[model samples]
Target: MVLSKVGKKINDYATLVMFSHTIFSLSFAVISMMLASKGSPSIHTIFWIIVAFMGARTGANAINRVIDAEIDEKNPRTFMRQLPQRMLKKKEVIVFTAVCFLVMVIAAAMLNPLCVMLSPIALFLMIIYSYTKRFTWTCHLVLGITSAAAPVGAWIAVTGEISWVALFMGAANTLWVSGFDIIYGAQDYEFDTINGIHSIPARFGIKNALCFAALFHVVTVILLVFVGILSGELGVIYYIGLGIISILFIMEHRIVSPDNLTNVKIASYGINQIISITFLIFGFVAVIVK
Candidate 1:
């Protein structure tokens, strides 16, 4: 009975953090790690990278939920979330977040001195992004930066140094995330405007926001092309993944519009997941072939 209760509670926390959504960033991180290692990272490195990502993402998500609890309660679309629905207490979530961060720091320490030094900065970026919506319409970009940290940090973990290739990977991730985020934010246009929560959609309207998203995605592809070139390792397979990603991005935009955001979830979540996984697979193949 106690075990079952514990299991359920663990599941609840996972749901609260949207744990499965880790795929979105994990794929990019893994691809970056492989590139940094020239397609041959140690198992130990891989384990710690995965641990760090899980800890950072889960903690960041938990804290975001706690910080935005009241706002989420007021937003019709988010009112059913764990916090707003009383599925998780504020203190419980806060404690969980702290534990997750501790795990992240420990994982970083296990990796290298550089990763240890950078962990706190990554944590700060992740935490600060949640509050950006209250003050700036650039919140989506802030979020993209936070998400980009995953790939950049993974690259550093492997090479123990920064490189242009890593920066290109980070930039690609930043623009890709920011683009889809603009589309996702459109679903909350009404709630955000009324609540004074800044977002591209709230500030510029959905139609214009989608346009900006498309532009960002276009740059995302270009930056990815640069990443391929800069690495001097990735090849046809990587570029093929980019092509598929471009098509997926187009499909993402086609399903939603200012007048009809009913499929926003599919566009922002489902398609992005496929894109990430597709990139991860093809990137690995390219790396191995080289």
Candidate 2:
């Protein structure tokens, strides 16, 4: 009976944090790790990196849920989420977030001094992102920057120093995530506007917001191409992966528009997952074959 109750609680927490969404940023982090190490980082490094990512991401999501609970409750589309629906209490989530951050710091300390020192900045970014939507339409960009830390942090974990390739990887992640977030935000446009929550779609209209998303993605692809060229370790396979990604991006954009966003969930989550996994495979192969 006790075990079952524990299992159910774990499931509830996972749902609260959308734990599966960890893949969205994790694949990019691993790709950057491989590139930074030229496919040769120690197993110790890999383990701690994954742990750190999970800790930070889980904590960030938990706190985001807590911070946005009222807004989420008011937004029809999000009213069913765990927090707003009361599947988990606010104090429970707060404790979970605190534990996650502690784990993150411990994992960082196990990795390297630089990672340990930078942990606070990462925590700050994660915490601050939840509040951005209340104040600025650039919230999507803030999210992108926050997500960029994953790849950049992974690179630092492997190399102990920042590099040009790391910056390019971070930039690519920033734009890619920002672009997709804009599309996702389209779903909440009306709610956001009604609640005075700033978002691109609410501020600029859905059609214009989508245009901005496309422009951001275009820059994302270019930045990725630059990452490949500048890394000098990635080549044909990597570019081929980018080709597939570009096609997916086009398909994603085609699926949703001002007139029809019925497929936004499919375009945002489903296609983005495939894109991230594709990059992970091709990126690893590119690093390995070189």
Candidate 3:
């Protein structure tokens, strides 16, 4: 009975934080880690990188749920989420967030002094992302920037220094993430606009917002091409993977329309998982073959 109760509680927290969403940024982080190491990083570095990412991402999402609880309550689609439904108390989630942040700091310190020094900045970005939607229509972009830290942080963790390649890859990550996030936010358009929650869909309407997402994704692919070139990994395999990602991107937008978003869940979550996994696999192979 006790074990079942513990399992249920764990599942609740995972749902609260959308634990499966970890793949979105972790894929980019793995890409940079492979690129920075030219194949595979030290086992110790890889361990710490994963730890840091989990800590930071979990904490950020937990806090975001708390901050957005009221808004979630108003959105019919999100009303049953743990925080909005009161399945989890704010204090419990906050404690979880604080512990995750501490874990992030420790993981960074274990990686390197540079990572440790930048840990606070990374934490700030994580915290700030939750607040951006309250005031800015460009919150997707803000989220992109925050999510960029994953890949950039991985590069620094492996290389112990930043480089143009890392920056370019980070930019690509930003655009990719922002593009997808815009798609995801489109589902909340009516509720967001009614509640004064800023979002691209709320600002530009779904069709135009999708167009903007497409543009961002185009730039993302271009920036990725640049990453391969500048990073000296200009292999056909990488381009091939990128081509697949582009197709996935197109497919993502295809499933959702301004008038009908019946496949929003598939577009937002299903295809995105495939994209990230494909990119990470190809990145690792490209690095090895280079």
What Cα-based lDDT does every candidate model obtain? Answer: 0.93, 0.93, 0.91
Can you write out model 1's per-residue Cα lDDT over 75-169, one digit (the tens) per residue?
A: 88889999999988999899999999999999999999999999989999989999999999999999999999999999999989999988988
Q: Candidate 3 residues 209-247, lDDT tens each?
A: 989988999999999999988989659898999999999
Residue 225 lDDT, candidate 1, scale 0-100? 94
Worst 10 residues of 2 by lDDT: 14-23
Candidate order (lDDT): 2, 1, 3
- Which scores greater on lDDT, model 2 or model 3? 2
Cα lDDT for residue 157, candidate 1:
95
Could you tell me how far off, in angstroms, the CA of residue 104 lies in candidate 1 after the best superposition? Answer: 0.7
Per-residue lDDT for 114-146 in model 2, tens only? 999999999999999999998999999999999
Per-residue lDDT for 231 in model 1? 92
Give the Å error, residue 205, model 2.
0.5
TM value for model 2: 0.98
Pairs that clash in candidate 3: none
